[model samples]
Target: MRTDIELDESLMREAMTLTGLKTATAVVEAALRALVEQSQRHRALDKLAGIGWQGDLGVLRDPRSSDPE
Candidate 1:
């Protein structure tokens, strides 16, 4: 967790300014968290996309209709 690596100074400064993060570490951590969340959301959307809609909306919306199952 304490590994040191090189990063673009201008990019880091811009990130700090945009995010209002005072330190490089904070900006990096925030970026990592955002990346992880975005990836997870994309994966979830992909999974949902694969499982297409299977039921009729009219039946679902009708209050008097008996249970189809």
Candidate 2:
């Protein structure tokens, strides 16, 4: 896919340097991927937030400390 758009030169250069990407397209794609992944992670966290957890979290951290019944 090809599209024409204007991007901030300073921001683009910074992204390129940080990501070590040689082209504007690569940098843009990488940024898009990161944004999409972050959004997905946020969505998953939000869904999990609505659930009611009843178990003791401490047991998971140290199973040996918990008595086996």
Candidate 3:
């Protein structure tokens, strides 16, 4: 968790300014969290994209349908 790596100072400053993060550590942590969340969202969307829907919309929208489940 304490690995040190070189990063662009200007980019770091920009990230700090944009995110209102005071330190490099905060910026890095926030960036990592955003990356993880974005990856999870993309994976969820991919899974949803693979699913197929062939049901009638009118039946779902109707209030008189007997079988709601």
**Which residue runs of candidate 2 sit more than 4 Å off their true CA positions?**
56-69
Could you give candidate 1's per-residue lDDT for residues 1-69 as a string of tens digits? Answer: 998989999999999999999999999999999999999999999888867778999987898787757
Clashes of 1: 0
Would you list the clashing residue pairs of candidate 1? none
> How does model 3 fare in lDDT?
0.93
| Superposed Cα deviation of residue 40, candidate 2 (Å) | 0.7
Q: Would you list the rank order by TM-score, best first?
A: 2, 3, 1
Q: Give the clashing residue pairs of candidate 3, or none.
A: none
TM-score of each model, paired residue for residue: 0.73, 0.76, 0.74
> lDDT tens string, model 3, 1-69?
799889999999999999999999999999999999999999999989958989999987988975758
Clashing pairs in model 2, backbone N/Cα/C closer than 3 A? none
Stretches of candidate 3 exceeding 4 Å from the true structure: 55-69
Q: What lDDT does each candidate get? A: 0.93, 0.93, 0.93
